[model samples]
Structures are given as C-alpha cells and as structure tokens.
Target chain A: MKVLVIGAAGMVGRKLTAALLAAGQVGGQPIESLMLADIVAPETPAASLPIDTIATDLSEPGSAASLLQARPDLIFHLAAIVSGEAEADFEKGYRINLDGTRHLFEAIRLSAQLYRPRVVFTSSIAVFGEPLPAVIGDSQDHTPLTSYGTQKAICELLLADYSRRGFLDGVGIRLPTIAVRPGKPNKAASGFFSGIIREPLAGMEAILPVDDSVRHWFASPRAAVGFLLHAAQMDTAPLGQRRNLTMPGLSVTVAEQIAALRRVAGPAATQLIRRQPDEVIAKIVAGWPQAFDAQRASALGFRAETSFDEIIRIHIEDELPPVQP
Target chain B: MKVLVIGAAGMVGRKLTAALLAAGQVGGQPIESLMLADIVAPETPAASLPIDTIATDLSEPGSAASLLQARPDLIFHLAAIVSGEAEADFEKGYRINLDGTRHLFEAIRLSAQLYRPRVVFTSSIAVFGEPLPAVIGDSQDHTPLTSYGTQKAICELLLADYSRRGFLDGVGIRLPTIAVRPGKPNKAASGFFSGIIREPLAGMEAILPVDDSVRHWFASPRAAVGFLLHAAQMDTAPLGQRRNLTMPGLSVTVAEQIAALRRVAGPAATQLIRRQPDEVIAKIVAGWPQAFDAQRASALGFRAETSFDEIIRIHIEDELPPVQP
Candidate 1:
C-alpha cells in the first residue's frame, strides 16, 4: 500500500509520519512508498522504506493533481490555517482552507474512474459554535462562528457527497483541541489551551488567558494519531453516507487542567501559569464546546484519555526527557 | 429600497417578483428600482418603477461583481438547479450551485465597505439526509446524501460565516419541498408531490411513484415567497451567529394528500392519480426528511399551511383559472 500525507511538516503531521514509518504497514498491508507534502518540504526522516518529500502549496490549482499523480492508496490530509490566522485574513483563509481542499477533492474525482483511494481528512470541533449544549451530540448542527470552522464544515459536506458519488472512500474526523501540543505556540485562538500546559511543563511561565472555570474538550497528540489510523483502517461501510465523526476527548476545566499538571509535575509547574485574563481569548473560548457526546466515533472504536492526569502523563511520556535519579 | 433578484426566471422567483411589484414597497420602504438576473433574461413585467433584466451566468468570474455594481439594498438569491439535474451533472451543479453562490457572496463582501446588503438566500431542506429522526429538529446535523443537498449545506455554512464576519447581513431559509408547484412537471424527484395534484387538477393523469404511507414536508410557492420576503425584512439581530433557519412546513403522508384531493375536487380528481412505484425516485425520496421541528423558524414568525386541503386550495386559487359557476 502506498501512502500520502499532506501538510506533513506541521507538528501533528510530523508525528503522524514518524508513527506511520514505525508501523511499516497499515491494516496489515506493507506501505510500498511514502509521499510527504507541505508548504515547505518536510525534513527527511530516517526510514528504510522509499520516501519522497515535496514542497507544495495545495491552494495552487494544479498542485493537488501533481500530488495525485502517485495515486497513493491511503491519503491523510491534515493541511489548514489556524483559526486566528483564518479569521484575520479572510481571503487567504478561504483560498487555502476552502479552495485548497476543494481542489484536492475535485482532483480525486477527476482522476481515473478506477482510482478510488481512502481519504482521511482531519476536521475540527470548531465546526460547532455558541448556543451549544454543554455536551454537543454527534448530531449537532454546524453553526460555525469563524471562517476556519466554516471551511472545515464545507469540506466535510463535500467529502460525504464525493464519497457517495463513488469518487473516493472518505472519512472526516473532527478532532478535539489537541492538548499539550508540542513546540512553540502559534496563532490559533485555541493555542493557549496548549500553551498553559506545554510552557509550564517546559519550566517556563505561560499565560492563563481564561478563567479557571472555563472548560473545553481535549485529546493528546497520540490519541489524535490513533484516531487518524483508526479512520484510515476502519470499515467505512458503517459510516454509510455520513462520513464525518467527532472523536472522543476528555472535557476539562482550566482548574482541572491545573490540578492534573500539578499531580504530574508538582505545584512548581502549576505556579508557572499566570492568571492574566485576556477578554478576547476568553470570549473565543467561551463559544467553544466544553464536551461532546461522540457516541458514533466512540462506538466505532475511537478512544481518548479518560482523565486530564492521563492526558498530562501521555504528553510527558511523548515529549519530555526522562527524569534522571 | 433598491432590490436585486438573482434567479428571476424561476417559479418562486417570478412569484416573488410579482409580489414585490404589486406591493410597490418592502418593509414600508418604497421600491426605487429592481434588477433581475438569470441565465436567461426574465420577461419584463409591466411596472412604473425602473427594472432591469440581465442574462448572466453567476458561475463565470466577474459576473457577480457586475451585478453588485448597482449595490441593491436588498438581494434575493433564489437561484439553483433542481436536485435531479444537479445529481446528474455534478460539474454543472457545483458550478452553478456552489461556486456561483460563493461568487455572489464574495462580490457582496468585496463591494463598498459600508454597503452591506440584506441577502435573503433560499436554501432547501434537502440538506438533511437519512438515519433521520421522524421529525428532524432545526439542529439536525447536515449529512446530505446528494450532491445538491451537499451544495446547499455548504452554502448555508458560507452564509452564516459571512454574516458573522460582518461582510454582509444574510439570512438563509431552508425551504420545504414546494407542493402544488406551478407549471409543467419538472424532473425533480419530488415533482410527483406536486404532480399528483397539479396534473389531475388540469385533467391530466399524474404518477404517484411511492406508497401512500410515504410522508414528507411541504409548503406552497406563495408561502415560500412569503418566507423569502419575511427573511428579507426580519430583524437579523436575534439570529446572531446562526443566520440559516429551517422554515416551517406542513408534514403529511401521501394518503392524506389523496384524501385532501378527494375532499377538494371529489373522487374524479383522485382517480387521475396512477400508482407506479419508481424504485429510483422512491429510494431518493426515502432518504429525504419526513418532517421538521422548525420551532426556531416559527418563533421567528415564518408561517406555512397546516393541512394538505389548504395547500390544494392555495394551488387552485393561485395557479388555476377562476371557476365559472
């Protein structure tokens, strides 16, 4: 089986690529070749198998077709502009997020009639907006409050339609906010959710923008990758016409996150979180879903950390250096 | 206020235009001018107010910008190819339904910074698909099974996002299947819902493709226009981030429809109906929404007929020649 990973330079993308390389095979079929695409060519990782890294901007009209020429059997599309950037620059956001995804789907449809590959698209929980129930159900309407969310929702609809039309076998997984995201903070409005945890864990001061009572959903990077793999290998027959699924995640308040961080790294790490209420970030976070009844995805075997303590532990194990005696 | 009607040639568009002309005002504001646009130029209606009919394909670049040159205060975007056509011709469907609508919205966004038009977009209940509740709520997740439904659902997302961003004041009303639809039967799979009553009323036989137990939601063309007009004039303040609404409609089974036809025009009219189960259409209709909990729309003051008898009377009153005693 051949594999393709778009946006393979991002944090999650890099992690996913490394995991795929380690696995050697997906659903028991050995991966023959791998193609990694991003806005900038990804760093070549140590792998025994044949791998190709290409710098490509998917927003460009012919870019998707160029990537499709390899006809990888399984494609993981994780490309997207963050929420803040998307909201700030409307044209750029739509061009990259909406138009780019459409181009990819259209290219797949126009490819040889017999070429139907499994497409695993990463959607976001941003698809849900304000006036949300405390626990959003799998059947909640998509009333996106931001351009980024809107673009994701549109792509999900297109994925279902294209799949129903026999253009491709597609599954859209709406991932929860990735907690303890590795690396430096970015422009996503949800960045602080990770920043407070990641920065503190790295023994650096981090801004706590929202109130301790502010709650949101989360999943570890490993869990997210697990979701991607499950989606790629799962029986799409159960998905039927509704190809999108909201992955299960832990729901935690800011205070609960702090408690978990303290439990894992002591009060010293918790002290690094400075309570500086940023109204803008607070407002954005307020509209986000606190939890979800991801019954469908859960029923289909997707899993996540049951507690924030487990989440923090997973982060430490995955990203932190081992403590010496 | 100056007004623009995008699909001025269609049945609902024509009726909406006629209603606007007859009223000579909207929301108590005297009509200054009217611009009608379609793929084919609509026939000019006699009116003292200035009106322009332009033939243009909105899918073509710059076409939308040309239409926005007038900067009409109110815009009625009632344009879209019917379901069967959109299902058959995927490219044409996306071009006209999705890209065209986006072009129009983008044009509005790019128009004068201060010139925000009241955009009343006609969406369809087809946005909902199966595994559906017997009575779908306004919050039902959009899992459209068809290309046309997918396009509509995507447009609805775009509409909400644009409205939230303050680019335009938009309202998307998801219209129920228009029953007792005017003129000749078209290829829409839902055409029989009207045909059973329409063709029979005109002394012609009509095909009933599904069982009498089959149930669906509906509204008259006149009611649809009312919904459009109401959507145009209603205070959008209450809508906030969620600008799209599922308009209220009467839900009745085919048996009730036949019974209503019998009550209205006796057994003679009911006998004109022929039962010829069309597997293709039956399957398509089967996936459609049977009813809706359009409480939000109703609370917002949009109204529809309560009974099929009333719906049949509406068709007789609006489309048929006056009865000569």
Candidate 2:
C-alpha cells in the first residue's frame, strides 16, 4: 500500500509514521512506498525503507494539486495551524486550516479518475468547546470556542460529505489531549498538562494553571498512535453516513494526574509542582469538556490509556532524556 | 435603511426586495437605497425606486469585497447552487455556496472597520436530513443527506461563530419549502411542492414522485418574505450565541395540499395531478425533515402560513393568470 502522511514531521505525525513503517504492512499488504509531506522538509530515515519526503506549504495555490499528482492510496491529512496561532492570526487560520483542507479535498476529488485515496484527517477535541457538560455524548453539538475548533468542525463536515459522495473514504478522529506527551510544553493552553508531568520528572518546577479539581479528557501519545493506526485499517461501514468519531479517552483531574506523577517519580516529583492561579487560563479550561463516553469509538475498537499513571510512565520511557536535563 | 441583496435575481430575493420596498423602511428607518446583485444582471423595476443593480458572480475572487464597497447597512444573502446541481458538481457547489458565503462574510467583517452591516442569510431545511424523527425538534443535530446540505450546514456553523465574534449582526433563517413559487418548474426535487399546484393551474399535468401520504414542511412566498423582514427587524438579544434559527413552517401531506388546492381552485386543480412514482426522486424526498417544532422562531415572532389553503390562495392572487387555458 502506498501511504502519504501530511504533516509528517510534527510530533504525533512522526510517531504515527514510525508505527506505520514498523507495522510494514496493512491488510496483508506490505507497504511498497511512503510519501511524506510537511511545510519544513521532513527527514527520512537513511535506511532504504522506500520513503520520499517533500517540503511544501499547503496553503499556497496549486500545492494540493502538486501533492495529489503522486496519487497516494492512503492519505493522512494531519497538517494544520496550531490553536494559539489560529486564534491570534485570524486570516492565516481560515486560510490554512479551512481553505487548505478544502483545496486538498478538491484536488483529490478532481483527480479521482486516476486515484481514489482513502483519507484520514486528524480532528481534535477542540471541535467541542464551551457550554460543555460534565460528560459529553457522541451527538453533542459542536460549540467550538476557538477559531481552530471552528475550522476543525468545518473540515469534519467536509470530510463526511466528501466520503458520502464516494470521492473518498475518509475518517476524522477527534483526538483528546495527549497527556504525558514527553516534551517541553508548547503554546497550547493545555500545555500545562504535559509541563507538570514532563518538567517534574526532569527535577524542574512546573506551574499548574488551574486548581487540582479541574478535569479534562486525555490519552497517552502511544494510545493516540494506536487510534490513528486503527482508524487507517478499520471498516468504516458501521460509521454509517457520518465519518467523524470521538476517540476513546481517559478522564483525569489535576489531582489525579499529580498523584500519578508522584507514583511514577516519587515524592521528589510532587515537590516540583507550583500552583499559579491564572483566572484567564482557568476560565478557558473550564469550558472544555471534562470527559467523553466515547462509546461509539470504543465499540469500533479504539482504545486509550487506562490511567494517568500509565500515561506518565509511557511518557518517561519515550521522551525523558537518558541523562537528566 | 440601505440594504444590499445578493442573488437578487432569485425568487426569494425578488420577493424580499418587494417586501422591503412595500414596508418603506426597516427597524423604523426609511428605505434610502438598495443594491442588488446576482450572476445574471437583475431587471429590477426601473421607475426610480432608488435601487442599484450590479451583475457579479460572487465566486470570482474580489467580488465580495467589491460588493461590500457599497457599504450598505443591511445585507441579505440568498445565493446558493440548487441541491441537485450541488450533489452532481460538488466543486461547483462549494465554490458558489460555501466559499462564496465565506468571502461575503469576510468582506462584511473587514468592512465593519468603518461600518457594521446587519446580515440576514437564507439557510434551508436541507441542513437537516436522514435519521430524523417524525417531527424534528429545535436544536436537533444536522445530518445532511446531500453535498448542498453539508455546505449549508457548514455555512451555518460559520454564521454562528462570526455572529458570536460580533463581526456582523448575522441571522440565519432556515426556510422550509416555498409553496406556489412563482416560476416555471425548476430542477429542484422539492419542485413538486410547487409543481403540483403550478402545472395543474396552468392546464398541464404534474407528476408526484411520492405517495400522497408523504408529508413535508412548507411556507408560502408571502410567509418567506415575512420571515426575511422579521429577521431583519427582530431583537436578536434572545438569540444569544446562536444566530441560526429554524423558521416556523406549516407541515402538510401531499393529500392535504391536494385538498387545499381543491378548496381554492376546485376539482380541476386536483384532477390535473398525475401519480407516477420515480424511486430516484422518492428516495431523495424521504430523508428530509417532515415536521419542525420551530419554537425559537415562533418566540422570535417569525411565522408561516397557518393553512396550505391560504398559501394556495396567495399563489392564485399573485401568480396565476386571470384567464385559464
């Protein structure tokens, strides 16, 4: 199977690509070749794994067509402007996240005579925002607070329509916050989720933005990869007309996360935490859905980390420096 | 009141314009000027009614910005590719409906640096389809069956977000099938709603694709005009964050419509109807929402014709020829 991974160089994109390569085969078919794309030139492994990397900005006109010329059998569209940037630069957000996705879908649709690609789009829990209840159901309305969420929701709509029309077989997975992400905190509002765990493990202080009682949905990075792989191979028939699914996730409060942190790293890890009451961040976080039933997704074989402790351990093994920072 | 009517050549657009002119004002402000636009140049009344007609295809880049240059106080967007055409030419649908609406919304958002325009967009019941209950309630999930419905749903999402952001005072009214539309039978699948009455009154045979037991939602041209005018003037404070509303409509079966036609135009109107089942068309009609509990719209003072008989009478008074063939 010829596979294409868009946004191949990003963190999750990198892991998903590695998993795809490691599996080496899907549906009893060994991967013949892989085409990877990113705005920055992606670095392919030196070994002859039959991978080609291309650097191009998807927002540019004709970029999607150029990418579609390769005719990838399986396309994973993971490219998007991140949340903070999307909210800050309004035009760029709509241009890249919304318009760029549309162009890519259009390109593949217009070229179906030669290639019919099955696409996997990475949507986010961002698609669900403020006015959230304690537990979100599968059919909760998408009331996205951020521009990024709005854009993602729009893309999900597009993906479903495109799939319905038989232009493509597509699946959109609304990923939960990947806890124990095993990296320095990025600009995401929920970065603190990782910061508290990652920094504390490295014997550094990490500030908690909200109270310990604050809760949100999470999944380990490994579980997220599992979701991507499963979505790539699963039978989409039972998904019926709608192709978007909220992936199974673990719900945890800050106190539970800290307890898990202490369990994995001992008393020293708990000592590295600082509480900073940031009302603005707290208010923003408050609106996010705390948990999801994910009943449909789990029934369809999607799974997540069982506990925050398990997630933290996975992060240490995968991301911690061999030598202390 | 200065108002701009996009898709001014459409049936609803013409009726809305006439209503505005007849009202002589909006929100207690006198009608000063109207700017009309469409792909085909509109032939608005030439008797110095203070109207400016511009023929422009909004799908063209920069068209929206150019149109907004007029800086009208109110904007009524009633433009879209028909559902069947949209389903057939997916790209064309997105280009005209989704992208076109986005460009116009963006134009209005940017134009607000100097002037904030009040926008009334004509959404359709097509936004909801398939897996619907016998009577769809307000706030039901949108599961559109066609590409056109998807585009409309996507646009509705944008409308809500933009309104929340205070870009424009946006109001999206989801209209029901308009009965006795004044025109030749168009390609719309729901054209049967108008067809049964139109062709019969014109001394021609009209085919009904579904059984007379099939029911659907509808409003008259006059009621549609009322919806536009009300949406233009009503207090939107109660709408809060949600700007899209399902307008009130009369739910009636084909048999009921036939009864109303008989009452108004005698048995000849009923006799002209021919039953010829086409599975293709019947299948399409089955998925649409048959009843809507439009409480929000009703509370907001938007109403439809109470009876299909009144709807038929209005069609006769305004559309039918004085001398029958």
- Go through the candidates in order and give each one's C-alpha lDDT: 0.93, 0.87
Q: Per-residue lDDT tens digits of candidate 2, residues B109-130?
A: 8875657678899999998877
CAPRI rating of model 2: medium
Off by over 4 Å in 2: A46-48, A321-325, B46-48, B199-205, B262-268, B320-325
* Error of model 2, residue B68, in angstroms: 2.1
Tell me chain A's TM-score in each of the predictions: 0.98, 0.96
Return the clash pairs for model 1, or none.
none
Label model 1 with its docking quality class: high
Error of 2 at A28 (Å): 2.5
Best model per DockQ? 1
Across residues A1-325, which tens digit of lDDT does each residue of candidate 1 receive? 9999999999899999999999999999999999999999999999999999999999997999999998999999999988878988999999999889999999999989899999999999989998999999989999888899999999999999999999999999999999889889876778888888899889899988889999999999999999999999999999988899999999999899999989888999999999998899888788899999899999999999999999888888999899897
lDDT of 1 by residue, B1-325 (tens): 9999999999998999999999999999999999999999999999999999999999999999999998899999999998888999999999999999999999999888898899999999889888999999878899887788899999999989888888899999999999999889877788999999999999999999999999999999989999998998999999988899999999999999999999999999999999999999899888889999999999999999999999999999999999899
For A9-108, candidate 2 gives per-residue lDDT tens digits of 9988899888888889775778888988998988896445688899988889898898877687888999998998988888999989998898898888
